[model samples]
Target: MAKTNSTAVAAALTNNQIKRTVDRLAALKAQIANLETEADNLVDLLKYQGKGVYFGNAHKFMVTTVTGKRLDSALAQSFLTPAQLLKCMKTTSTTSGRLYAL
Candidate 1:
């Protein structure tokens, strides 16, 4: 019958739409879980480091060098604290400026 055929087509379309929605939701849930896991790991690492001590991951020579330059500019506000400058020196290219306590 014509009515039966139309009803079957409508049911198929509804099923297809529901399937796509569920798939998208599952993908979003997976991405959220991954982000949460990364946040938890970072929080745990920070907790392990406690207060005052800095927490940093090891980097290659070039990455370290770039990071040093960025830090020098970035930390200029904190009176360029000795510890920060020393951290900069370990990875720096600059040799003219001597670090002094403020």
Candidate 2:
């Protein structure tokens, strides 16, 4: 009878341990799911919203004129003429520097 009680106790302990492990695993899974959802939300916020100039809106934006100081004299001197710069713009879809898509 003593051996039987010991065996029963061990079996109960094992079952409780297994149940606790399963519960812990389930909670971890739920936490991962929530994290994934938050990650997706953050990605949506960070990525280009495709709204600025790509979408045709009723609002008319002011066309800002480039000041003479804005032009790099050294860089401008590299090109033969403004026509060369215009040609480069026509040929290249994307510029080497930071791109502002219009």
In order of appearance, the predictions have TM-scores of: 0.36, 0.34
Which residue pairs of candidate 1 clash?
A: none
Give one digit per residue, the lDDT tens place, for model 2 in 51-79. 33322376432323355756675687586
lDDT of 1 by residue, 1-102 (tens): 367546465564567786775676677777998999997887676656544445358631121212333445665747878786777565547656232222
The list of candidate 1 runs beyond 4 A from truth reads 1-13, 51-102
Q: Give all candidates' CA lDDT scores.
A: 0.60, 0.59
TM-score (C-alpha) between model 2 and the true structure: 0.34
What TM-score, to 2 decimals, does candidate 1 have?
0.36
User: Which candidate gets the maximum TM-score versus the true structure?
Assistant: 1
Model 1 / residue 13 / CA error / Å:
9.0
Per-residue lDDT value at 96 in model 2? 55
- Number of backbone collisions per candidate: 0, 0
